[model samples]
Target chain A: MFKLLISLALLLWVNTSFAISLIVNDSVSFSPDSSKDIRNIFTLQQTHWENGNKIQVFVFPDDNDVHQQFSKSVTQMFPYQYRRIWDRVTFSGTGLAPTIVNSMEEMLEKVSQTKNSIGYIENIDKHQSIRVIILQGDENEAQ
Target chain B: MKHNKRYFHASLLQKGLLSLLLALWIQPAFAIELADNIQVHGFLTQGAFYTSDNNYNGDSDDDVSFDQTEIGLNAFWQVNDRVDFSVQGLYRKAGKVENGDVRLDYGMMNVNLFNDENNHFGLRLGRIKNPIGLYNETRDVAFTTPSILLPQSIYLERSRSLLVASDGGQLFSKHQLGDGWLSIKLNYGNTHNDNDEIRDQMFVSYAHGDLDSEDGSFVGQIKYNYQSDKYIFALSYADVTLEYDSSSRDLIPFADGTARFSPYIFSAQYNGEKLSLTTEYYYSENEFKDFGAYSPDLSPITTNWYVQGEYRLSHKWQAIMRYDESYLDKDDRSGKNYEAMGAPGHMGFTKDSMIGVRWDIRPDVMLRAEYHNINGTSWLPNADNPDRKETKRYWDLFSLQMSYRF
Candidate 1:
């Protein structure tokens, strides 16, 4: 009985550590106006503010662990596949790939300042400037 | 024409300054977080090729020797989560055309129809690459097969009937099937031009692949093509009839021979981290009918296949070797033949065995030097005069090509 309790505790700890949360600035709103259902605040396609406006996007840089998790949860596509798809899109004159931002603070600041932007950041503290868009998994369970 | 020239000059100057400024700006920005929402990137490739037999024939004396150069540029821009666009341009010079001629290889808009958590679908329409073979699909500068030289059997030089662009649409869908994944692509469109004397020829091909991992994969494709990739493969069973004016009627031995033809191909490819191989077999048969009694029946069968291997010596250099052979059966004369001495010649065989080295000057550019020993029997008729034949025994051919992508 004691061994079972210890093992259950360890599994819970592992699951929590691996669990990822996506966050966005509160200013952005869910839009039926755009082709998709949701949008985030970002700038320059990265998480930077361009003239005090935030941009929006789908993925992050190569080294960010949170970015990797977010990508897996949201698109189920790896960084390589995402990049290839973006490359094809860009070369075909379709649209641009999303920009990358560093740190949650930068993502928050950029998103708060930008309009019609979208992005994903780690959820920790709730803020007035951003809102957490609930994501559902393949099982339709909210992540 | 004058206004177009002026616009071209002005754009050239503007692009030069913009590129310089972009390079400077991007260098400092690299340290920070990448911008979000939208990103702009592109690549350019320029290359030169020198061939021993410029005429593409075994006869060296007819020597139409020249240097060939080509430049390709590709750009991509994403609008939002579900929409994107890309444009590619190519400039090529083969013989003494003086100024290089430019053509748009791919300019298309892609719309993501379904972008769910696990699945995505996209549709593209414009001047797109004809995805007939494994290598032909990725003919763009950024994506290339392992070898420096694509298999000539499919991507033949000067064969616009094959490897050319198509004004069409393609639909692609991907779904995660349990542990592995599957992708399906369907393409439908018309040929760019009626170069083969056949008008409004339609092409349809299907490709499917399963991803085992990042480093290895298998893909298969089937296509019905009317154009010749390199040297004509005679295994096609489609009907090809030539449209003849009264003046040219005497030149043709058969008055009722149709000029329509069709070809069927089955191809497969496997790619590993260090090694890749692709092999294909094609069959085409031309039938001539409604000709006079003197018309002879000619049936030809052609078989073509090539195997290539590559070893990455380092990040910047690689070595490759390829062996290619094609055989045609000329003795089968079920179709109409237009000669008094029965069929003009027996079905012949051609072989090109080559070994080459490629230097990756950069990710978007490469330089290759190759040597090929070519041996062949029989000859194909020239476009101008069908009665004349050009055949050769064996020759040593040396070639050098530089390819780049911007």
Candidate 2:
């Protein structure tokens, strides 16, 4: 019975953990030079592309499952931390916040349609123009 | 103009209640998005306070009083790629001290001068929020703070107007360093006028004259955030000056003086997924010169510090504990210098220990309750406790607040 319980707990943990990929629009040809660039972009530290086209970020809401995993796995930050950063910037009139979508499908759609936009999705859906950018480092060593 | 203030206060409280209902019914529409890329955001926070001995926010001597309220609305308009316009209107009532009034919180046009892959820089002109410590800029917003009352050792409530915002220019820059980001912000501006409360605190209501900041103040800060805020360290400095012009009809002898204050702060934080640790230290040198014939020039170096820890119990619940300390003069930690002049010895400093819990009912709504065990009257507003002698050396304060934002 103990072995069965342990196996069930492991299964539950595995079912909850999922891989998230960073997606960019078709107009973007270059990816982040380093892992820090990914964080800088999403955290509003980096606002423009190297070519000067402004980056319009789209993402799921803070409570969304995929968004939570993406923040911890892909961006290597907690959802609450991102929320705090966004709220501080927004209220203090320091910077702008990303457009929050409702679902992963909506995220995929927005990134594909918007120019120079970036977001994360659990898996690549039916999208011809949106490209998935492979992050450089492991999530554990991101800091 | 006599009954006008009471009428206005009543309306503001009504507005606060009205918006609270509106938030509950229409949660999504709280954030209004315009067609031309303009986004509107705001927050409403209502608090109830009860103190075991002293007064806070209202007549809270053993009675729950709902006198602290903050209502604000801000708009961000992306005018173009290089410039954005931001404006906000605030109505705050923080006790008998800060009566209800509609004031412009901040109105600025941030012009993006330059940006590239790894660096971004900007110049913000107009009325801007002063970047003090981590929570000064967004102090009034309840959703952004961990507890109802922030560490009063540094973010003092009496000097709210002087430290809140400035009407001048600010330059901000962010650079991506090796495995981290470095941000620097510098501000130079004249403080807005509202010195009656501050003057009363300093002179015990003796100066019935105008007290204002004639010279512009300067504030600058540099911060390095590592690993997307797993670790953070910051250094902030400010030089502020004020002048008090005494009137002939005052109660006490005429005392005209200039006060120069320079405060240096070092802040550090470690943010983990479930727990966070933060500590900040303040070293301030204050000089008071030329305050009449009898009063000698006095310069005191004040010291204050606080250490806090926050643990996330779950996705929507959080608990925080903090120990904050402050001294009017580091040399007179025991308040003997002031006791020599016939005053409560405990009034020279304050040591506060607080514990709080927060429940995020929804993404836009929050409920929080906190208790503070305080050992002095240093940071208490003079308006709340007019007779400082009646205050208890060891007192307890309890507060509850509900906040909604989008």
Candidates' lDDT values, in order? 0.42, 0.79
lDDT of 1 by residue, B53-100 (tens): 222321222232223444555555555556666677766543322134
Candidate 2 lDDT by residue in tens digits, B280-385: 8999999988878634687989899999999999879999999999998888887775565445678679999999999988888889999999998778787877
Q: Which candidate is the best by DockQ?
A: 2
Given candidate 1, what's the lDDT at residue B214? 17
DockQ scores of all models, one per candidate: 0.15, 0.44
